[model samples]
Target: MKYFIITGTSRGLGEAMAFKLISPEHQLICISRTKNNDLIAASSHLDYYEFDLQNVNQIEALMEQVFQKINLTNADGVYLINNAAIISPFSRIEQANSQDLMDNLHVNLLAPIVLTSSFIRLTQHLPLEKRILNISSASAKQLLPGMSAYSAAKAGLDAFSSCVGLEQGVESAAVKIVSVYPGMVDTSLQEQARNTSNEALTTPDIFKMVKDRGMLASPAATADKLISFLLGHSFHQGAVVEDLFL
Candidate 1:
């Protein structure tokens, strides 16, 4: 059986991914802010943990509870997707609230690192292939106004992934680390962006284009590609594993 531990599975791209991977052969553990009855009713293989990623103090204990559901003895593979994020307080660097910035860091940057470490420590002896996917953004590469907090957090995630990959290479561990930049999907994040009161921010205009021109990608389609990559079902074997973005 394959194991998948995904964060932010209650809605949007994360929700898309959770439903995409459900199967008799796949055991899913979702971390979210609320319980998903539909997901639980979908299959016995589905399980979830409802907790805020912003609560940095409880992550360790939470992960312990998560691992209890996994059947490591019969596990064929493992995957971790750090998909939870916040789009609030989308303001310029100076105008951003201190509390908002801190919250963003906790959810977007720190949670993934904590979860990745937990996965590595727990699965070291499992003798199964493991993959880590960090959901990143185009904002990480460009200077977009009003996205200072989001941009900084995602850029940090990408750099962190690279460093982890390098360290693993020296020891030759059987693990894959990637940061995926899922192109603008038709998600609620857009709604949040559009509602921001920051007048200096240009995100609203971009979001408007996405909505009016029908340029947004479907989360379900993106989820399929991401899961395919994790399962090593890709057609392009020569592609750099570090560059996969759904």
Candidate 2:
């Protein structure tokens, strides 16, 4: 049996991933701002925690409470999946407010870093095979005219994860860090990005494009692939794992 911690379990990819990881034999701890009734009604091994990732200072306390409840430190291995993110509706850089950009940074970049750091510290006594999978975006690689802040933050996160992987190797720890770029999916964020008033947005008619090209995959499909990769493949083979067109 394996223990897993996943964030943003209320909806979208996070929700799908949580359900994918649930089974009679494994344990799943899901965190989000609101409780997901589906996950709550699932197996007893599934647990849920309601916390706002925007409140960065409470993350450590929240983790402590979760570990205390699950007794996770005694486990042979743990998987920390940082899958939560926020995208600003503002399309243009000038149109984006300072606070909105900062909020994006908090949720997208800072929160993941802090959580991964905490995971490393908390699992210091655990055996090898502990993994930290960071959900990233292709936007980090290509510049989208409208999504400046979101793209920048994800890029920072990718860089941070790469550095963490190197540091772990140097420390002779078995903990592996992987930054994954899951291709665009049919999610609310896509809807919002498509509707945002960004004149220079390169992803013109985002919803229509996704529909026309049949490019958007279901969240469940993406979740399944991610779980398969995490369990069956070695993420340490590469610092950044690209899951495009999967």
Candidate 3:
């Protein structure tokens, strides 16, 4: 059976992906800040963890517990999808609060790095396929005025993925890694941006324009494409891609 360890499964694209991946042939271990009753009622082949990712100190223990749910004797492949993120503190760099900045960095950047490190370390000896998919954003490549924290965190994720990809090349059982921009999905992150006051942002119109034109992709559709690319043969290891599934 295939195994999937996914984050932010409480809602949005993560939830959509979880719904699509449910089957007798796959086992899902989902992590989120709160439990989704719908998800619980939908599947018996899944394990749910209501743990916050921002509490980076406890991720190692969490992963230890997560791995215990898998039986390697019957395992076909193990995958880690780091899809949790926060798009808050959407203010000019200097105007943003220090606490918010730290929280943003911790949630969006440090947490994934630590999780990936733990995932690789824990699964390195296993004799099975392993892959890591990091959900990135276009903000990583652009210089948006109010998105410094989010952009930097995503950019760091991309660079970190590249570095990890390089390291994996020398290993006999290298774990594949891909950092992808899942495109402009109609998620809470977009809502937060659209709701932000214009005075706090330099490019506020961009969000407004996207919404006005209905340019955002639905969470279900985006998740469908993302999961297809992730599980398909076209996935290139260590690639930092933008709009690849589109």
Candidate 4:
């Protein structure tokens, strides 16, 4: 059976992705901020763990406990999706608060790094195929005035994935990694854009682009696309990619 370890599975794209991975043939272990009772009701394959990513320092031990349930020798493959993130307190770099900066870094980037490290270490001797998919954002590449913290975190994730890929290239049976930009989904971004004051966002019109212009992608559709990407092919190296325009 396949094993999927997903973060931020309580809501948004993370929740949708978890739902798709649910099946009698697979086991899904979720690490999120809260319990998803409805999701748990949906499948016996689902296992839930509640812990806020903001407390990034505590994840390693939790992961160790989570990994104990899986027998690597019996699994077909293992996948990790680091998908929890929040864009809050949008502000210019100079105006950013110390605690918020630290929180964003912990949730958006540091958690994934720590999780990936644990996954690698725990499964180092196993023959199982390992894959880590990082949910990335356009904000990483685009210039959004008030998104300094979010942008830097994602950009750092991208660079980290790329470097890990480079290091794994020559090694035999190294884990496959990818940083995917799942275009504007009607996730929290929609609400933030519609609600946040224009003065806060550097590009205030982007809110209109997502909500008013009807450009936001559906979270379920994006999750389907991501699952397809994960299952349809073997990714050899770390890649920064977007959902293909089909």
Candidate 5:
């Protein structure tokens, strides 16, 4: 059996991935701020945690609780999908809110780093295949106005992924880590971006244009492609991928 610990499983791509991964051969442990009732009713193989990622200080304890549900001795693989993030307070650096910046960095960067560290530390001796997939965005590399905090966090995450990948390379039981940009998906983040004031986002029309042109990918489709690449032979550890390997 393979165990998957996924964050932000309430909705969007995270939710889609959770649904796609449900099976008798795989057990899913999902963490999110709120629980999805439909998801819970759909599978007995799922273990849902209605806890917030912003509380980074408690993630280790939370993971310990999550690990209790798994039988590590018989597991063939363990996966952590750091898919939780918030893109808000869209403003220029000069105008950004301090609390917003802190919250954004906390959820998007710090939480993932801490979680990855915990996963690596806890499973270091395990001989099973271990992999970490960090859900990233194009904003990390693009120079968009009013996205300083979000962009910085994502860029930092990418750098962190590279460093950890290097650290794992020499280990006897190495863990595969990859940060991927999942392309433009029609999620709540996009809605927030589209609804932001012109003062906050200088390129507000970009979001509008994407929707108008019907270019935004669906969450289910994007999740399908991402999961395929994640579980497929083409996956490369330590790669800072710009595309979804599409």
Candidate 6:
């Protein structure tokens, strides 16, 4: 049995992942700004928490509550998926306010860092495998005109994951940090981004390229790959992995 913690469970890729991972043998902790009744009702093994990713101050307390509820300790192998994020509408650099940028960082970058830190502290003595997966975007690799802030934040997160992977390896911890690009899945976030701005919008052709040629694999497909990686043979500490595009 595996213990899984997934953020941004209210919708999009997170929601799909939660549903796909639910089974009689696994324990799932779903975290999001809001609770989805369908997800809560679907699995007896599932636990739901409503958390605002933008509120960094409450994360520790929330983690404590989650650990207490799940009876998790250092002995349990834990898998954390930092999947929650804010995308377009607030995507553009010049169009975004300081508050917008901060909000994006709070959820996309800062919250994950804190949560990973807490997880490391909690599992430092555990004998089980510990994994941290950061959901990234193709925008992180290049200059995305309207998605400057989002891209920047994701790039920072990718860098952070790489550094964490290296440091954890040095410490001989079982913790592995992986930054995965989930590609363009069919999600509300994409729909929202498409409708939000007329200027600097990603054309359908670009979206198709992401889905077909880039890493935008289907949510179910990506979830399967992720589960395989998480549950199969263990890897060395601090390994950095990207989901294969092909």
Question: Model 1, 213: alpha-carbon shift in Å?
Answer: 1.1
Q: Please, what are the lDDT tens digits per residue for candidate 5 over residues 1-246?
A: 999999999999899999999898999999999998888999999999999888999999998888888899889999999999998768888787788889999999999999999999888889998999999888899968878889999999999998999988945489989999999999898888888885645677788889889999999999999888778876677888898745
The C-alpha lDDT values of all candidates are 0.81, 0.81, 0.90, 0.84, 0.89, 0.76
In the range 63-179, model 4's lDDT, one tens digit per residue, is: 899899987767988999999888865777777889888998999999999998888788767777788899988789886788888999999999989988887674657888889
Backbone clash pairs for candidate 3 read none
RMSD in order of candidates: 2.6, 2.0, 1.3, 1.6, 1.2, 2.8
Model 5 stretches astray by more than 4 angstroms:
170-172, 198-200
Residue-by-residue lDDT tens digits, candidate 3, 1-246: 999999999998899999999999999999999998898899999999999888999999999999988898999899999999999888888888998999899889999999999999988888888999999998999878889899999999999999999888846588888999988888888988888885866577888899899999999998888888888886677889887754
lDDT of 1 by residue, 2-103 (tens): 999999998899999999998999999999998888888887998888999999878888888888878788988888889999976688778878999999
Which parts of model 4 are misplaced by more than 4 Å? 170-172, 198-202
The candidate with the higher lDDT, 1 or 4, is 4
Clashing pairs in 2: none
Give model 1's TM-score versus the native structure. Answer: 0.92
lDDT of 6 by residue, 165-238 (tens): 87787454558887767766777777655456545556433554654555445677767776666566643345
Best-first order by TM-score? 5, 3, 4, 2, 1, 6
Model 2, runs deviating above 4 Å: 72-74, 170-172, 199-204, 244-246
Against the hidden true structure, what lDDT does model 4 obtain?
A: 0.84
Kindly give the stretch of ten consecutive residues in candidate 6 with the minimal lDDT sum. Answer: 236-245
TM-score for all models, in order of appearance = 0.92, 0.92, 0.96, 0.94, 0.97, 0.87
TM-score of candidate 6 relative to the true fold: 0.87
- Greater-lDDT candidate between 2 and 6: 2
Clashes of each: 0, 0, 0, 0, 0, 3
Lowest summed lDDT over 10 consecutive residues: which window, candidate 1? 234-243
